[model samples]
Target: MNTGAVLLYHAAQLYCNLYKVTDFQAKETAGIGVYSALSLINHSCYPSVKHYFIGRSLVMRAVRPISAGEELTISYIKPFQKAKKQERKILLQRYWFSCTCEACVNDWPTFPNLPALRFKCLGCKNPLDGRPRVCYACVTKRRDPDKPQTEQMEVVDSIWRGILNACCTDLALNIGQKKTREDYLTVCQNLQLLYEHVAMPCQHVIIMHQLLYKYFEDEF
Candidate 1:
């Protein structure tokens, strides 16, 4: 081969070595193979689509609704969480590109759907000023002839713990194998619904929201 042809051959080999066969399902590394079409898909932290191995062929699906004319993007690494600006720059170094996705652009805020950290009162569902024994809306109710202050607070606390534990348990179980996009998204969305139902923001709920945003922000 001519020198130019020889150089081209080595470059192709190196590219395959770096980007080919992302993972092994069974126990054989020899099974690694690359596809030209699959290689063309670019990397994004907030990908609109996802791909998985189906036997020897690859299948791609939209993880979220996509507008016409929008680019189809997928992640080359685990991407369900936000990272610091510097951290993102470091992570993108492997792919050799600068990211300007919404997360990167905004320095990774909680996904657009979830906007605040304020918690609601268990009694009246109003936002709390700070941690308190009683909310403004509930103060009068607690003082009524039939309602006792201590009893109401205890009931609210019990209900809150139960919801939080259920959410945490469901999320942990779904993080394992056989988990699907629906599985993870359901837990995340349910947490949001629970917050709305209770009319309160919680530390654990906020953390779950953040985690969900990190991984599945593009989904919804």
Candidate 2:
């Protein structure tokens, strides 16, 4: 019998729990025991069942309904990453068979790299070789490119929120009244500018403005 058929038989014998099948019958399958019963379910590049683990237990659920006579299948790994050559080696060594899946047919890369959405500074764009510093050219630019500007604004907004939260909780004031007032005023002014220009005038900015107004009103 093929590796997939053998796995199915083993899964059936273990009452359909791949985890238990692998754990109890590991010596029978060689240390190549299945990580999930779903693993024994055979493989298709496009599979119906999505398998994951709930702690040590292998959990399998239908990604879509299965029809009769269709070989029940699960993914050996993410289809996008499993090149034909690599998959064949794994299946031959571990499952004792060869794989013939659509993913393999297409000659997809064994490890697909995900695309990044952020722009890097022109001077320090290397992914592996730099401790990034603000580039002089970037500083000279009138406006930052979208990605860096978005990141900077996010940091500033987070700091402003932290300051507001501290004021609301009375933590800032408890340290020293003068210091608290100065910090609060600085945060409020910076927040106002960030809200107007950087935060896109979102409702959160309006709410924060209302909160700051109430805080100062009550204090004064």
Best by TM-score: 1
lDDT of 1: 0.55
In candidate 1, how many Å is residue 99 off? 1.2
Q: What CA root-mean-square deviation does each model show from the true structure?
A: 10.5, 18.3
Quote the RMSD, in angstroms, for model 1.
10.5
What tens digits encode model 2's per-residue C-alpha lDDT throughout 1-220? 8999998887675542333323321223223235533545876654555554333455554533356977777755444344445755564454445567654565434433322122334444322112234444444332444555566557666656765664555554446443346555655665544433432213343344434533442223
Weakest 10 consecutive residues, lDDT, candidate 1?
211-220
lDDT of 1 by residue, 1-220 (tens): 8999999987775553343332324324435666667677777766776665545656676654467999888766545354455766786776667877655675544333444445555567776555555677767333453343344455445545655654564566567624346656555455545555433223444455444433432232
The candidate that achieves the highest lDDT relative to the unseen native structure: 1
Give the Å shift of residue 136 in candidate 1: 29
Candidate 2 whole-model C-alpha lDDT, 0 to 1: 0.47
Estimate the TM-score of every prediction. Answer: 0.45, 0.30
